[model samples]
Target: MSEADYFKNMKHDRNDPNPFLAIFMDTSIPFDEEAKAIYLRDCSSKTRQFLLPLLRPLARLAIILLQIYKSVVPNALTSSKALHRVLYWGMKTFVSPSANHMILRHFYLGSEVLQFIRDNVPGVDVTMNPLKPTNLEPVKDDLFLIHDLNLYNFIINLNRELRDKGLEVKKRDRLNFGAITSTRIPIEPMPDRWTNFLDLTSAIEIFTPVYQMFLTDNDFWRATNSLQLDETVGLLASKIIGSNDRLALINNKHPMVPLTTLRAGFRLVLHGLATEQLHALLIELKHKQEHADLSWNRG
Candidate 1:
């Protein structure tokens, strides 16, 4: 078949033999692969921090307007959207600072945590004495505990969920357990059949060298720079996703990690002193990433 026809056939899943997308699905982790697959599915259901950038300013604006109205006007304004904005702010205020992921209007139970915390962990004890500090030093002026009772309950629920899946903390695979160390809250494992996760993310170390070369590949880089196509290309490179899920994918955008990588979500990285060749290449990569990030799928 011709090259265009070959790529067209690859248009489906990573199961297709296009090396660009195949590596994502072919690799396996030491733990049960199905469990990894379930983890990916749950992660996808929750908005991912690394896939897309959030328009937090807009959310902030909605919240602020609602707050001001609540302060002076009191019960005058009662639109459902306004109620939502006010509720959203309260939820964000109570959420753990470590929650780097996007806070959606959905996720109703998130609000329940605050209520649980306040009901149990009040600012004062039975003697009516103020409690300990609000937050960590420098982060918040006061140290406050969000009522450990709720957190204890959350842990209970989380553990129970894992147990129901036939996974016990005592018997959990070391590989999957270790992955949780890298994240704040441990994400649930995939069931036994889904992900072919591998421990050697290091073997993927070849990625850095390969990315550097791609950074320097001006002609090839130029061909891949269009925002419209870059989305699809990034999805293909990452596996487990494709560009058709536009908004969902963009919200996966994570923070700029200091670690150097070939393609952190499809952006090439080059590491070398400022030689003209590499300097020009870095500039090109930055441009390509910025160009790729725009919502070209929209008008």
Candidate 2:
């Protein structure tokens, strides 16, 4: 189904607007070229700006290396399983308990990203740190459903308005609460060095709140199991990739796109995405008002 059709199915009060919507929606935020230029000036780092572009090429190389590792390493390991078993037995027999603890510490880094995103990102003004992730918090189950419905209704109405203006929004098959059967994914707590930037952590911080603002409020209910940074990030990232991919479909065809160039910059991208979402919320509200007025006149 088209995004508008899918959104129309969302549960929300058609007559009343939620007051707390402002926490997620900021219609006043600027997203034009002038605002983007200013964001670059305030938030850009010279070294990062230079090195960031290079990552695209490195990403390609990493993919190749990963393919080779998966293909070659598995067979090699299988061939060496007997030797490995002997080595494992010898190591267990010889290695002390204290030595194992030290080895684990060497592999385990602190969960700084989780702590930083949860404790710091949401409370900070995005205008100042546009790079930070949208703040997502665990809410009461009842509250989650209410807000989720509100956000769903807002998007549905906004898409209808956009369609009236001759815009085409495609169906996005990204992750959502209704579609999600399970939230079990491999949790790699330590991200690759390439993604271990402050901007990534900041961007991740915004994921939950941004996602909740867009999808069903109860979409993150599965995450209540542990709220571990890796698992939560995994859930959030899946939705984010889905949302971005949906936007990409529109952007690919349209001559003018939002946040196309600066999207490579983590902070800039987060702001651009959040700005678009907030704009949708405002459009939805306006459409609701217009409909209300028409109904009143008809009465």
Candidate 3:
């Protein structure tokens, strides 16, 4: 039931040292940090001005904090008192105390905390689990598993390595990823961000051959539908949550299937919760997950 046991079961044959990337696309480009900071702040202001007129004051704070977070997060992921105006903005806009509190809840704002850990904190482990509910009933054809991961951080250790030598360009990024354990940053390992950054910096292509990187329906569907899955998978998945994405290729009839299933899975391992708290959790999951959806270009 441990993560080590779970990852051990994977059918990994690749000698690819960097994360086994399924790069959707990779053209050589150049990109940096200071430039990143300025881009972040500009984008924040524009978002606030645009969202302000239509939203309540508290909602306005939600938009604004995200901006301040961008400005301050160039260094860490925790809230910055230096830019504490977000609080003032929220209270001013959301007059309903309950509504105002909801808008400023820490989890949404805790994105900064995550960033802080990534930059300043040291030695934190993150776990991800994939335990979304599927048809547990004996319906033969209706049985399909939609597994999503939960990330936990009890034991991952991180240590930074600089100017790593002897790395072929293709392998450089993976080494850095490997070194990420001893550090306290909680950034996810999803290919779109960190891996892409590495590829851009090292001039290595993600999913270079593109064809092999593509996930075949057979590859995903068969894996999902497997009834004999190791039960320890959920625990294993929890260790990798931030590093992986919750995905679905199910029939379009169930657009929200992934989140719904995750709701069920939460009940299985978690229990004895207050009704109000549980209710709130589900609501946030629904709202944030909608924001989490991705768009892809048809090839």
Top lDDT model: 2
**Which candidate has the highest TM-score of all?**
2
Off by over 4 Å in 2: 1-43, 73-249, 252-299
Q: Ten residues in a row with the worst lDDT in model 3?
A: 200-209
TM-score to native of every candidate shown: 0.18, 0.24, 0.18
Q: State each model's CA lDDT, in order.
A: 0.27, 0.30, 0.24
> In candidate 2, what are the lDDT values of residues 197-294, reduced to their tens digit?
33222222323333222222123332221121222232233233333322221111211222222122233234233433322332333355567779
Error of 2 at 2 (Å): 35
Instruction: Give the alpha carbon lDDT tens digit for every residue of 1-299 in model 3.
Output: 42223223445456852221111111111111221222223223422345433433433344344444444443343322322233233233322222222222212222222232233222333332222111112111111111211111211222111122321112111111121112222222222222122111011011111111122323222322221122122222223333212211112122223221112211211211111122222233334444445322322
Model 1 residue runs over 4 Å out of place are: 1-39, 42-54, 76-299
Query: Per-residue CA lDDT of candidate 1, range 1-299, in tens?
Result: 52223333456554554443343254321211222232233333323333222423333343344445445654453333333343333223432222211111101122222222222321312111222222222112111112222333444454455456654223111111110111122222222322322111211122223222222233112222311222322232122111122222322133222222223222321110011122122223334544655656453
lDDT score for residue 85 of model 1: 43
At residue 95, candidate 1 shows an lDDT of: 28
